[model samples]
Target chain A: MLPILIYGTTLGFTLALIAIGLSLVFGVARIINFAHGAFFAIASYTLYLFFITLNIPLPVSMILALISTATISVVMYIISLSRVRGMELNEMIITLAFTIIVIELLRIYFGPSPLGVPSFMKGGITIAGYVVDMQRIFIVVISIATLAALAFLVKKTRIGIGMRALAQDEDAAMLIGVNREKMCIISLAISAILAGIAGVSVTPIMTASLEGAWYALLNGIAIVILGGLGSLVGSLIAAFIIGYAEIIIATYVSSHLKSIVALIFIIVILILRPSGIMGRHHEIEERV
Target chain B: MKSRKESNKNIRTIRKERLDRGARARSKDLYVLMSYEDIAYVILPRVLPPLILLAFPFIVRDTYWHMVFFLAGYYAVASMSWDLLGGFTGLVSFGHSLFIGFGGYFTAILNVWYGVPIWLSIPIGTLAGAAMGTLIFAPCLRTKGVYFSLVSLVAPLVMVGSILAFAEITGGEEGIYGLENPLTELQWYYIMAGLVLLTFLILRKIAYSNFGLVLQAIRDNEPSVKVSGINPVRYKVTALFISGLFASLVGSLQAHKLSFVGPSYFYLSISVGIITMSVLGGVATIIGPAIGAYILTILTEWLRWLGGLRMLLYGVILLILLNFKPEGIYRYLERTYQTFERQVVEE
Candidate 1:
């Protein structure tokens, strides 16, 4: 039971990190950004290339991976977003294509085999009666620190205010002389950075592979649907629920049935409450 | 001087007459050109392609390539059926393979378990496919576009799970096989070719009819179509039923040809492949999906030699096409052909 708790907490942290970025993108951009998982995969591959192949230090490799992913995301936004402006279907298709392309490219480069990063912390730590890996504990701490930092930035900084305004109302934000384009670029960059951080942090615990993108995408979508598309607090809660549910289900039932169960939950939730648990039914007018 | 002035006036009159004649000739040419286009697009393909497809297997020898051709023909028919519902109706279904798989499995089970003849089992399978489509997806018509797609996607995954859980009947991951009678590959090829041609001709006739236009209208705007005194639901469901019919037929044929059936045959990847074919060919066009299926089928066969590179290349190509040419290769070809015609006319 203790081990399950630790596992659930670790899973929740990783999921939250991924979910926050998705939440931000959805809140501000109104685009589902299906390629977000692809970005995460790319970040993982970059870390693998740096640390495992080039013999670089893990910390330095992770920072570089984050930066690289951010750069790629910004570039992708410039290329795909320009055409998809104000069109939800177009945006979905374009992002779906992007995800496919990225996953395929990774498969071509790395083959179908899974790769892993060395755990940053080498030993296990005991908390109460349960022994947990130090790496998982580090992940939880880092995730908390990152979320706190993100909240502070959004609350305290001028850019954060601009982002908030943009999320609330784009036209009004523009009327107030907010640089909409710049803020959008910044939002995408930050979103990508968060995904990159999640990717690198979780790579040691969960090996990175082509299938990783699909797993991340499915979890992220479930969380967003359950939590509410643009709600950070809701995302955190949903992630915990999902993380715990998955752990418990896998422990009690067949592991293979976990995806089917999660999918059913999503379908049930969507049919019953499309706006999600905490989401409001607002007409989210997005310029793609 | 008087005689010179008279000659000049005569010359001017002759020039005027020549210009009038030229204008008349140009108008006549335009009429002829329009008639030719009507015959070529509306009449000729309607008549010729089906005839050619029917007689194709008779001309070709019973070789491995011929087997491939039969497979391609089957897919072409199935893909065209998909286009009717998905492309024309703007209802993108990712679980189309569910119908195909259902049809195949139903036919196989009927033949293997009950000793029913293959011919009797095929229609039953097709009807079962149509019923499944209506029961599972027709309710989703109440929802809008993306929601419908989401439901369809989940439905297939559920089906996959159910198939696995009920392994005793389904044969599970190991699959069900050896239901075919002893027939030559050539005979199978001809039989499939004949079915494909028949299916194509039927679909082509529907496409050129007023029903096709109404379906397109429904796709463009459901509320507007409703306001225009048409029941969108009826047309959508009809399109789905027709598509299901063809899917089941193909599935039945596939099961018979391979002498086996499996869950993988009806997997999400197959649905993706169908969508790719339809999109690559140009959605909503009659021949586009057939062409797309032919090209992609051949590409896939060739890519088998390259191992993992095939899937990687396939994914990359899909992305590039979606990004660069969303309307697909068929639309691109149509545009080029139009431009070429204009250039020829101007010259």
Candidate 2:
């Protein structure tokens, strides 16, 4: 029971990091970045390529990996998403297509097998007679730090305010002298970096593979839906809910049934409350 | 200098005009055919593709190409089904494989475990598959545009997990195998060709009908449709059921053709491929999606030598097409087909 609690909190924090990025992108851009998964996978793969394969120092490799993730996210938006900005369906398709390309490229180069990454530290601590690795603890700590920084960035920073303005009303924000394209590109880059941070920090424990893209994406989507589409606090709460739910299922139920929890949640939530637990979009319900 | 002036005058006098051949327009809405050429012009475009498709078996002697046609036929039917709900109705489902998988699995279970004959199992599976699809998707219809699409995308993932959890019945990754394949290759080919024509004609008929217009209206504006004394949900549900029927039919046929059924049937790639085909050929046009399916399926097979790079290239091509040719191939072809140029002298 203690093991489940320890693991669930760790999983919850990791999900919060990943999902918050997805929420941020969707909230600001209204472009469901299906390629957000690719950002997650690409960060880990780039880290693997630079750090392990190319013998770069770990810190530099992590930074380069994150930079590449940001570059890819921006490039993706400019090339495909920018044209179909307001067309919701087209945005989804383009992002989904981009995801396929990225995932397939990773598969081609890295092979389908999961690649192992050595943890940053090599020790364990015992809590309540349960063994916890330093990497898992690192994941928990880094996730909280990143999330707090993100909260500050959104709440207090100039760019973050621009992003918030864009999210609230695009035309109104533009009328008020907000740079829409710049905000979108910056928010997208930041979102990618957040996903990158999650990918880089957590891959050592989980191992990075092509499938991680889809797993990260699905979990991120599950959290976003549960929290409400664009609500940060909602996403944070929903992330923990899903994380603990996944861990508990893996612990007690058959591990194979774990992924279904999110999918089931999406279906049930959409059916019962399209706006989600903390979603303020009552218009969605009325449309239904 | 004198001859040059004459040539310029002639060029100015004889302006080229494009007109519909063999028909005289009485007004914007009415036309009278001046000759048999007009009748042929009206009928030929509608008939030629199907006639060519029917004649394909005789023209193409290679067994390998025949197999390719069979595969193309499966995707063709699937994409057309997608176009009905997605194109005509404006409900873009990202997990259409749910219907196909249900159909395939139902047939597999019935034939393998219950001793149901292939003849009975196929139709039963198709009906049951469609019914199940309507039931599962009915709840999701309440979700607005993007939300419905998202729910659809996730629904198949749930099916995949459930299959794995209930591995004993579903056969997990290995899936159910050794179902009956009583039909000969040619027989299967003819059936598929016939199905392609039947589905195309039927869907086209529906799309041009009053019912289809209502579906399109609902897609454009549900509230307006509701205000017009139409129940959008009823029309949407019927469209889903009809779409599922064809999707299920092709799925059951493919399962029988392979003598196997597996979780791969519900793969996201398959659903994505269907969407790609629909978008490529032309959404809202039954014939266009079929063409798209054939092109993509053949292109995929042609690029098989690239191995994993095949999908990467496919994605790149789709992205390029979506960006540059968002209107699709059929619309372009239709524009070229419906008009001809002739010289007319100005008085």
Candidate 3:
């Protein structure tokens, strides 16, 4: 039971880190950004290359991954944003295609085999006759710190206010000279950096591979759907719900059915409540 | 003598008039005019392309590679069917493998348990697929866009799970095999080729028809279609049913070709592959998906040397294409062909 609890917490924190970026992107951009998983996988793989292949220190490797992923996200935004314009469906399709390309490129270069980064903390802590790995504890800590930092940045910064305005109304924000494109780029960069940090933090525990894109994508989609499309708090809450549910299901039922079970939950939730737990009724205007 | 000469002249003129009318009717109805450019650019090239493709197996002489071509042909047909519903209708079903899997399973079961001949089982499977499509997707036509896609995606996953759970009938995860007919591989290739050609012709006709136009209308705007006095739901359901028919036919052919059927044949990735082919070929175009399928299949076969990197390549290429050429490769080819024809006509 203790093992399950630790595993659930570890998974929930990792998922929250991934979900926050997606929620931010959805809130500001109104695009699902299917390439979120690709960015995550790329960041994880970059960390693996830096730490395992190049013998870099874990902290430096993690920072490098975050920076590189941010740059790539900026490049992606520049390339796709103009073409997709105001069309959310086009944005979704373009991102889906982008994901395919990124994953394929990784497979071509790194050869599809799973790569792992060495755990930063080598030991564990004992609590009430139950021991928890130090790496798992680190994941939980970093995830909380990152989430707190993100919340502070969004609530207290000028750029965050601009992002909020843009999310509410792009044209209105532009009329006030909010620099919509710059804001979008920044949002994408922040999202990518968050995903990168998550990738680096979780790589030691989960390992990294080309196949990570689909798994991460599924979890991200499920969390975003369950939490609400653009609600940060909701995403955090939904991540835990899903993470715990999946871990519990895998333990009680069969591991192979985990994905199917999660998908079923998503379907049921979507049918029953499309707006999700914290989502409001949104008037979706036809953009294109 | 003067009256006889006059009558002969009149008779000759009347006969000549009749012959002229007959020739005109034949030319108008049967001998469609190929514009000089069309003759030079499209007609000449297309007429012999099939013959050339047919001659390929003869030249290669390797049965295994010929089998690969046959498989490619089947996939081309399946992908095109997917394009018709998902691309043209904008339904974006992620559960198309359900139709294909059902078709294969039904055909195998009918052929094995009931001793039904292969010829009779194929149509039965096709109808079953159409029925399943109506049952699953027709009701969801009221739901728009992502909702429809989400439902369709879940449908296949559920089907697979149900198939696995009911091991008594479906043969479970291990899959069903050993149902082979007495036909040789060469005969099967010919059968597959014939079916592919038939499917292509049928889809081309559908693309040119008013029904196809209505499907496109429904895709572009459902409310507008409804306001225009056309039932968008009916048209969407029809498109799904037609797509299912073709998908099932191809699935049945696949079962016959492989002499084995499995759940993997109807997995999510297969649906993803179909969507990839459809989008890569230029959605809403009749021939684009087939070309997309053929190119991807060949690319996949060649990239086998890279092991799992082929899928990665597929993803990357899809992204690049989506960014740069949302209209797909076929649109570019069509434009080039049109320009060449125009130039020939001008010359």
Best by DockQ: 2
Candidate of highest lDDT: 2
In model 2, which runs have C-alpha deviations exceeding 4 angstroms?
A281-288, B1-16, B20-39, B343-347
Q: Residue-wise lDDT of candidate 3 within B166-193, one digit each (tens)?
A: 6677788977776657787777777766
> What is candidate 3's lDDT per residue for A1-288, written digit by digit as tens?
887788888888888878889889877876667788888998999998888888888789889888989998888888765677666556665676677778767876787689877788998999779988888899899898998999888999999999988777778989998987778788888989888887888888888986677667777777776776778888899888888887987899856566665566666666677666777745222211
In the range B1-347, model 2's lDDT, one tens digit per residue, is 99999999998999989886433443554454557876676778878888888889899988788889998999999999999898889898888999999999999999998989999999999999989877877866865667667667777877887799889998998999999999988888999999998998899899889999998998888888889888888899999999999999898998999999999999888898899998899888888899999998898888889876766776887798888888788988887766678999999
**lDDT for each of the candidates?**
0.76, 0.86, 0.76
TM-score of each: 0.82, 0.94, 0.81
User: What is candidate 3's CA lDDT for residue B141?
Assistant: 66
Q: Which candidate is the best by TM-score?
A: 2
Q: How much is the lDDT of residue B195 in candidate 3?
A: 66
Candidate 1, B93-145: lDDT as tens digits: 76788788888888888877777787887788678866776666665464445
**B-chain TM-score of model 2:** 0.90
Model 3 CA lDDT for position B337 = 49
- CA displacement after TM-score superposition, residue B210 of candidate 2 (Å): 2.6
Each candidate structure's count of clashing pairs: 2, 0, 7
lDDT of 2 at A137: 89
